[model samples]
Target: MNKNKALFTLTLVFALLFVWTVAEAGSSKRRGTAGAMELLIPIGSRNLAMGGSDIAGVSGVEAGYWNPAGLSQINNRVEALFSYQRWIGDINTVYAGVVAQLGRIGSLGFNLSSLDFGEINVTTTDAPDGTGETYTPQYLTLGVTYSKEMTDRINFGATIKLISESIMRQSASGLAFDAGVQYSMMDEKLRLGIAVRNVGTNMRFDGPDLEIKVQPPGTEPGAAQRPFRVPLQEFELPAQVELGLAHDVVASESIVWTVSGSFLHNNFSFDEYKLGTEFVLNEMFAVRGGYVLAQDPDEDTFYSLSEDFIFGPSFGFGLNYPLNATTHLKLDYAYRMTKFFDSHQLFTLSLGF
Candidate 1:
């Protein structure tokens, strides 16, 4: 009877998500207008290599970013992960997360991610070429997550994130929320996940940089100028909804193979369909590959024929080593293909105890 109830709840949630996706299908028209775009950047080498298709099956500390519900599936009392990515345009991304399992209470996770834009020569209208000054931009996000297993086959989780961005004397900050659910069946070999992310208040920049001295209209040029502040418009976060499915094709003592797929509907960009597969051998080594296909809103088709999208295929591998009787260490690397710039490279280290 409990299993039946779980199934009913899952169906209801899926239906609601489908309606939301359809209702927001035209959101692509508003692409590139959202703020805090860093919230949409993918983190975690393992999932990025899988084209982020493992939302249904992702677990451990990394799941705090992908689908928080999966945090409840952590196998150890404590898990920690650190990841670094060489992003496009000479930007560097760093992420760190830790999760702790609390007996029957489930799991708690905290994560921080930041982007380094390096130093740029400060250029102004008068110094278009050289300002003899340099400044670094800061973009950071901090998240707190909680996940619990509602039943043997059902898991639920939520996260709250604080985002901060600053450049020169201007800065903006806001809060975002994320929630997800995962349901498993077929003896836990098949899984389904649904998540809503980046829902929050709008953000706008405010700082001394926006203040300027300007002469009032029709006033003498020598008249005392009035201080005027440039008004900045607030922008919404890039909200999105994701639905994912995964199934274990081969499950055994020595080998396991899983195939996964997901659909991501964006409120500020084109939709995406992701497909990926993973093969593990001896429970120690694994290889993964995946592809992403963007849906063109105008054509209503899945293809990136135009230059609007750059990311394509991705591949990666993982190595797991037992540190002791109850501890383990993992290393993962991923390479993603791109168009305009160098491909992205990511490395991650994880520990479980």
Candidate 2:
């Protein structure tokens, strides 16, 4: 699992705490909003050991966001997952996803994720500090997807999503989409995949704001018929493209080794390359690790604390329980260490029918 993004997500918070901790520094406190949607960190095997990625062969509701094409391999039943992430301190995130077969058509899935910002008191410079108002900043994501298998080695899928970010009295909302394709060979042991996600328009804020004073009673021309607009210019959405491949070596009926690699395209910035590998013992125990390197343009990041340093490495283990030949239960755990911050932990529960 990788929490590299945590550094980026909490970047502003560190500044917030600095304002409260460092006295003189607090005098010139920085008040601002962070740009960019944090990346979706990953922590699971069956893919991680290969190279920290799998674009062409995802097979669960979580894959709906990772790679929809994996949906082609659904077993005509229902599968679901719940994951908890301990990102640094005071920041906890939860994710839930489900996939179900749709008759002879294909497979459909849903996903939801929530991010909690804890609680903070709201204040303004003029109120001389506290207006006694407080609020929490929370973010949410919801998506639905459909996938179809066209051939033994080919699959296609797509998803639509709703995103919301809310703070004390203010909020922003938007929509996005993801699409994927996957192919497999070597008796379903070798695979490849590709996906494009978060490709959509920007979001705009809609809430009470600092109002302006104006004269009434038709004193102005269109003031009575039209409203003044702040038009918080819609900004660019976080868009990404990913390609990955994986291969599994069946050491025996009970043992297997898998390796995977992924090429990522970060639209708003430089690209990234990630690789991972895992070993499974007796289909019950697994161990995995991965490394990620960012392609920096400024190259100054050769030593920067920006989330751009996803360059750190990650590792973890997992346990799987077979309910039957076509179904089972799995628990996966992962950890990631950044070059300049607290490590992250990821735990996921999966149930397959």
Candidate 3:
């Protein structure tokens, strides 16, 4: 806690959670349902290079979501990742991750993701009511990341999480923390990163229908049924402050080139930037692209950005292969573009030993 007092306590907790979530959505009276569908929770798979350097030169098991200090660049005992998205029509996304490398006492990761809205048909008003409850809107995240390579050009990491959310029954769960740092230069080409994600606390949803209530069945006094707490609700997650940079151009023993950039500090939003590039043509063939925004940018950071469909411009592309050389396998793809939903795709599969 001394990087200028931890970046001034993470810029004063991201400016007081972005001014209390923009004053609770400018005093919402039910305006746009308080961030629904998060456009599918920004589906990810290394943003498929569409966001290059995905936080800091991603490595095996997809670094558990792009950074855990690049998972110590994996020494590989086991690493895996899976993902899929079909945005633009009936949105859908599924993600998976795995990692293991306990060689000197460091390295372990596991992650799972889900987002689907393929079922819905439950309503009520008693018979003016449609008593048929069909539900689906569950999100889960169980994570663990620990990395070490604290030398030869810096590396260190941390991640911990347990989060859950349910829909038709209004559920909520929480716990979160993450930390990162990575640096590699010259000979290794170049790389730099920083992370301070999520942090912790603020998920409140109780059991028993938040104590269900219904009056007028016999003039009962009043004031009892309460469990409200939902305004972009959170139990400490989605707090971001990532900065990244990358470089790798070794063209010749096959070929390799990478370029990346990223910066974000979204407490709920406003402040994002991404630029990417990747080309590996021989280690097994690969290609990539990138672009993202929060207020149109690739360079420019002093502070500024309050909102706008989260700023536009986004792109993607991917490829990879190699199933031998001690053991290796790879595949990745990505796409992102939104100003009003309808553009996002991701896929990832990896292995290394």
Best-matching candidate per lDDT: 1
User: Candidate 1's residue-wise lDDT over 1-353, tens digit each?
Assistant: 88678768866876786687568654546878889988877877788889889999999888888898998887789999999999988999999999999988889999999999999998889999969999999999999999999888899888999999999999999999888889998999999998888879899999999999998999877999999999999999888889999999999999999999999888878889999999999989999999999997767777653377888899999999999988999999999898888898999999999
* Overall local distance difference test of candidate 1: 0.89
- TM-scores of the models, in the given order? 0.96, 0.78, 0.31
Per-prediction count of colliding residue pairs?
0, 14, 0
Tens-digit lDDT string for candidate 2 (1-353): 12334333333433443343233110112211213264354523344433457565557766776787786575539888888877665577888888888866988888888887687777878776778877888788888889887565667788888888877656788788777777677887888776777767677776666244454665766564434545565555666677788888665788888778887765555556877877789979998888777665334243222564633677889898998898889888877775445677778898988
Between the candidate structures 1 and 3, which one is better when assessed by TM-score?
Answer: 1
Which 10 consecutive residues of model 1 have the lowest summed lDDT? Answer: 20-29
TM-score of model number 2: 0.78
Sort by TM-score, top down from the best: 1, 2, 3
For model 1, what is the alpha-carbon lDDT of residue 343? 91
Model 3, 34-112: lDDT tens digits are 2322322543455554554367677666665656767768655877777777765575767777878887776777777
lDDT score, residue 257, model 1? 97
Give the Cα lDDT of each candidate. Answer: 0.89, 0.68, 0.62
